[model samples]
Target: MASRGVGAALAIAAAGLLAASALGKGWISAGSASVGLMGGEVCRGGKCKTLELPEKDGWRTTGTVAFAAALGAAGLGLVAGIMGLARKRSKVPAVLTLVAALAALGGGIAFILVAPGKGVMEHLAWGAYCGVGGGVFAVVGAILLMRAAGAGPSYAVGMPGTANPAARTLMLAETAKVSGPEAKTMAPGMAMAPQVQAPRPSKGAPAMVPPCPKCHGPLQFAGQFNAWYCPRCQSYLQV
Candidate 1:
């Protein structure tokens, strides 16, 4: 239930992590030689040489992207956290933070997972962990904030998305229906007719009898001729 507090706390933590990751150095380190977002040094026999890469886009470029993305995520997460702590329902902050986090995650993957380096510390780098971790934290925090921002109520009866039983049962008392000549009262949210209907026959009902057209008298059944006989009318009657 304490969604606001929880969401705010998570966002703050994510912001802190991302901020540090974006600014910190030592993305990769082996002994005294260490690498960062821009460049690092290579040492041999107590001597060190500056690493030089192609002028075009390279791993450093990806690292730079990652650094920028991390910073963006941090800023967004901090804002989202502040909004959540204020007990305000705002989806913009959460959504933007999630987007920035995803970008940061993509950058981390590009440099930490895809790009290759000469040394053994290429994949096992502290800066890489920080970037990835911050992204993950931001993503989770954004999700919590989104949840904290309440959505509207679900539908009532006959709705697939309806989740509240109470809503489904609302207005269930008064309903009216009419089928054929008979009027049938029904409860709201209930079917007018049952799944199956039982057959009924009238009791003591005389069939195959008709009144004479002219005399208006009941015609007698004629079993032998398969018709009716009107004694008063004295004519063959069809029943």
Candidate 2:
């Protein structure tokens, strides 16, 4: 599961993509001359040229490339967020987040380096700054998510015992029980036998009688005489 901090960071980074897209358009001022850059209308001497993504130049323009990268990063962020929240966690989310951050970062850099304006004094617009900021935040969030994924349940190290002390103890105890004296003391020739107890009589059941004294045969009880007698012996039994 993605930590709350990491999730929040990814969300913020995704927002950066929007910011970057919006900020990548603006004018650069040079003395008295102002020129529009990437994704904006360039004005020089009252003449204007509009540039947009997938420009008429067949997507080869610097503006298109930079914006594309930013878009890619934003898409990756969404995917990473979904994967991070999956029931079964995996490294995919972390990888996706990292790729997203890198894409955004690269896009921002490209936007500055490949900006479509020629001016003696060029000033970047707020949108460019937002893109850069969002990229930075995304990178930070990705790193955190990766660390969290790898750490797993053992995130907290150097604690009193261990991260999952109860589980460890249960495992150890089970191992000990299996390897202890009762398991090891069995003889080669003799097998371990389960203990069998005599059946107990019910509360209202008659009591049992001893076998015959002479023949050790089954005995019969006489209710009227209030005495027990042996059938095979057929003799008066002593009280």
Candidate 3:
């Protein structure tokens, strides 16, 4: 639960950062021509021109890709957060959250690499800082969520549709072992031990005890006591 809460916060933060990065100016250009994320404007002899990102400029492609990636990360983070809330023990959501974080991180790196460095100088904007911060937060949240997934109860505990009948049978077999030991007797100064075969469910017969309705833990049938027992809840179940 705690991990889920943290994950939610981080995901929200990531979304905020990604939004800012997408809307704000992530790069700036100077010299004969000035180009920034918002737009590009022409300049001459250090005179400033209108701000716009022109389609003809090749560098704009890199910025566009990075922005797209950031947007994708933000969207994925929201999805992961929702999954984390609904399925705390599920690892799939955590993996997705990690992927989202990596996307933002990768995008930021790409933007840095492709940023203008020649006649058109580039400056890191607020969007870059926010994006980096958001990516870090996302990574931390994903790690926490993954750790929680491992510590939670089995996912199949309450979902009987996915439960394995063979596993339940094995569990019952192990439980039967603790009922009582084999009977032994000594006769004429000699000790004799009789072999006993564990009882098995008759072919096509229904199970002795079904899974607990609440916890889904294996149930034990106590023939001698004439009652079905749930080891998980330590309560006798109605026949």
**Which candidate number has the best TM-score?**
1
- Candidate 3 matches the true fold with a TM-score of 0.52
TM-score of each candidate structure, all chains considered together: 0.57, 0.49, 0.52
Question: What Cα-based lDDT does every candidate model obtain?
Answer: 0.65, 0.52, 0.60
TM-score of 1: 0.57
Clashes of each: 0, 1, 7
Q: Candidate 2: which stretches are off by over 4 Å? A: 1-4, 16-24, 27-38, 42-49, 52-60, 82-88, 116-122, 153-239
What is the Å distance of residue 174 in model 3 from its true position? 8.1
Residue 92 local lDDT, model 1: 92
TM-score of 2: 0.49
> Model 3, 1-239: lDDT tens per residue?
57668976787677778767766654443435433344556667767557655445355676666677677777777766667677656777667767867876876666666654553324555566787887887788777777666652563243232245456554444334433252132113322212222234443233664666666787676443223556766654433
How big is the RMSD of model 2? 19.0
| lDDT by residue for model 1 (1-239), tens | 36667877888888888887677555667677666555667789989888642334467788878778888889999999999898566789999999999998898777654446465444356766777777898898898888777532322323333344554344221111222222333324433322222122123234545566666687665432223456785654322
Order by lDDT, highest first: 1, 3, 2
RMSD of each: 18.8, 19.0, 11.5
